[model samples]
Target: MSYVFQFGPILDRWPLFLHGALLTIELAAISTFVGLAIAVVLAVSRSFGPRPVAWLIGAYVELIRNTPLLVQLYLVYFVLPKAGMRLDSNQAAALALSANLAAYATEIIRAGLEATPRGLVEAGLSLGLRKGRIIRHIILGPALRSVYPALGSQFVLQILGSSLVSAIAAEELTAVSNNIMMETFRNFEVFIVTGALYLAMVLAFRVFFAQTNRSLFRWAA
Candidate 1:
């Protein structure tokens, strides 16, 4: 089948595409922050809490990791409404993405926490540091350092995965591209531009994370 090459029509709707891209970024940002917070709590619980708490977190991580994100998104969007818990498409998408990212982040952070040296914990105790203080200052720092790159990669993936939100008419970049393609009748050209835009967004996120790492972990530098 032959495809049309109408870059002009796609370019004409640049403003709409720009709006969608901005929304995508905003959604990703909000989800990432929420996910990271959930991750920190879950990782801490898994690593340092009672056996039951640890087991619960482990189950949550396994369940989320084993399942497909699309299924999770669909369940959040469709099934919840049937249960009388209504949420709009964008809210459902954001909640699903945040929860999914939290699972991965939990595992990554737990690994980092596990890698912390026993001697440091002993040192903190000997220095009269409380368990909470040790975990907050000594452990959290090195643990985060160990997992920084993985966390950054996960954040980037979260941004890409946000594209799937478009399926629910969240008006993100991919959804905007679909509309553009339908309007312009230039599926290939519209997708090519959309793909480039996503790549640019990912690169921008990488740069921002790198700078954040430098500032946050000055000792690592």
Candidate 2:
């Protein structure tokens, strides 16, 4: 027996797929920004804050890093609603993805922070710069420059992993693919197209990061 492939029906849903792809990108972008912000705070606190505060942040990092993101999503979407803190699918997805990315970003950013030269920090202080100014002008930039590649890779991973949000019915690319497959009954064709879309998205992310890196950190390179 021979098997035939029919992608015509799946291709017919291009608008649906495009919408899903856009939403996936939006979720990843928002999560990356929010997560990076949280990560910066956590990394700074753990680096210089009081022992108790550092310990608490450390525990959060460890907890998120050790657990599965799926379980975390379940807790955020299902369990939190039971506690009267209801969130829609997108909100829950954003929260879970942000927290998840924050955990990994914390360590990556912390490594960059630790790699910063002590002399630069001293120089900033000698110039009568405040702690915030020193960190912003002297430390944060270099630290982020040092870890820009890693951060970019993490962002890509987060984008790909955004598929997990489908568990909560977030209407992202994977969810749309599922719906297409069900409606068209072209499971293999739908998945092949979906996988190709994901690949294109990942490549697009890489190109974007490369351009951004050049624009933002060419001097550091």
Candidate 3:
């Protein structure tokens, strides 16, 4: 069958698509920040908490990591509502993505934490630094520096994965494109344009993080 390209019709709805893209970026930004905070705590707990606490955190990480994010999202969105704790689609998407991202980040940051040298930790102790102070000043920097690249790549991946939120009708970029395709009957063209938009967003995030790392990690210079 010959296919007709109707990109022009889809382009007419650019404003709706733009708004959806903005929502997606907002969701990603919130989730990334919240997830990173949770990850830092989990990572530190795994490294320094009591045995039982560490084991619990490890299990949580493994469970989340092994499961599919879509299943996780469904539990948060559909199942939670059935349990009388309801969340809107966007909020549920953000919560689900944040929890999923946290599991991965926990492992990433834990690896970074483990990479700290024993000698450097001892040096901090000899300088009369408390354990917390030693972890913050002596270990945190090198650990983050060692894993910043991985973290950056994960952040980009998270941005791309945000598209899945559309399954819940979150009206993100992909959701917007789907709507446009339905309205304009331009399925292929709309999707192609949306894919380009997603690519641009990912590239923008990469560049932003690259500059942020340069500014934040001057010691790495």
| Best lDDT among the predictions, by candidate number | 2
lDDT for each candidate structure: 0.91, 0.92, 0.87
What does the lDDT come to for candidate 2?
0.92
Candidate 2 lDDT, 6-103, residue by residue in tens? 98888989999999999999999999999999999999889877899999999999999999999999889998888999689999999999999999
Those runs of model 2 whose alpha carbons end farther than 4 Å from true positions after fitting are 124-133
lDDT for model 3, on a 0 to 1 scale? 0.87
Which candidate do you rate higher for TM-score, 1 or 2?
A: 2
Q: What's the CA error at residue 128 for candidate 2, in Å? A: 5.8
Clashes of each: 0, 0, 0
Instruction: Compose the digit string of candidate 1's lDDT tens values, residues 31-92.
Output: 98899999999999999999999999999999999998999999899988899997999999
Sorted on lDDT, best first, the list reads 2, 1, 3
lDDT of 3 by residue, 93-145 (tens): 99999999999999999899988889999988998999988888887778878
Task: Kindly report which residue stretches of model 3 are placed more than 4 angstroms away from their true locations once superposed.
Answer: none
Q: What is the total number of backbone clashes in candidate 1?
A: 0
